[model samples]
Target: KRMLAFVAHKPMKIPGQFRKIFYEDFAVHRDLLDKIFWNLVEDSTVRSLNDQLDQVKAPTLIIWGRHDQLIDVSCVDVLENGIANAESVIFENVGHVPMIENPKATAERHLEFLAKN
Candidate 1:
């Protein structure tokens, strides 16, 4: 619950129905959470992808939450600078889970990016 709250800008504002589903999913995936989190941390610390960013040939759309607590928004600068064909959109007043925090905006941006790319 605390982690969920931290990931969202306003977890309390989430609709009850959606919140219920989210909690249920969290419960089902709880056992894997620590392993997944540690793996990501280890991978990021041990592996450096900065050199290979230019190898990516596909167009990329990077959507991020400006208020993300888990991953700082400053990382967007590195991505934008590294990838030749990369575009980014930052959601204001949103945290880590932009898809759940602002589904409409997230969907709209994804559709737009898909249509263009």
Candidate 2:
């Protein structure tokens, strides 16, 4: 969880001022905000996911860290097999958000993956 979990843990296209207002002026407290934000996330997830297991129609790639604290590492396997055509790469030294923490390495790894695939 983020020290600032008030905002959903994702990048955005929403206006900066508006994002602040929704997250602060309207949100009375952190606990309430966390509940609301998580609820919204769940609602949005249900809207997108029609089934528990889905099959991809195209090639897919999954990059995961072995020591991810936010989620179980086994989730990568679940994702790999769930897709129609999928493969994965795991970084042993990483925790979470490898792209944010190591852009250069992530980019290099991505370039390598693209070149090979």
Q: Which candidate number has the best TM-score?
A: 1
Global Cα RMSD, each model: 2.1, 7.8
Clashes of each: 0, 0
Candidate 2 per-residue lDDT, tens place, 1-117, comes to: 242232223432557787778668655787887898899789967775324437466667777766676766798888877776677887766656667545677788888778777
Candidate 1 per-residue lDDT over residues 1-117, each given as its tens digit: 687789987774658898799889988998799789888789878878877788888899989999999889998999989998899999999999999888999999999989999
Model 2 segments more than 4 A misplaced: 1-53
TM-score, model 1 to reference = 0.83
Alpha-carbon TM-score of each model against the true structure = 0.83, 0.55
Worst 10 residues of 2 by lDDT: 3-12
C-alpha lDDT of candidate 1 relative to the true structure: 0.89
Best by lDDT: 1
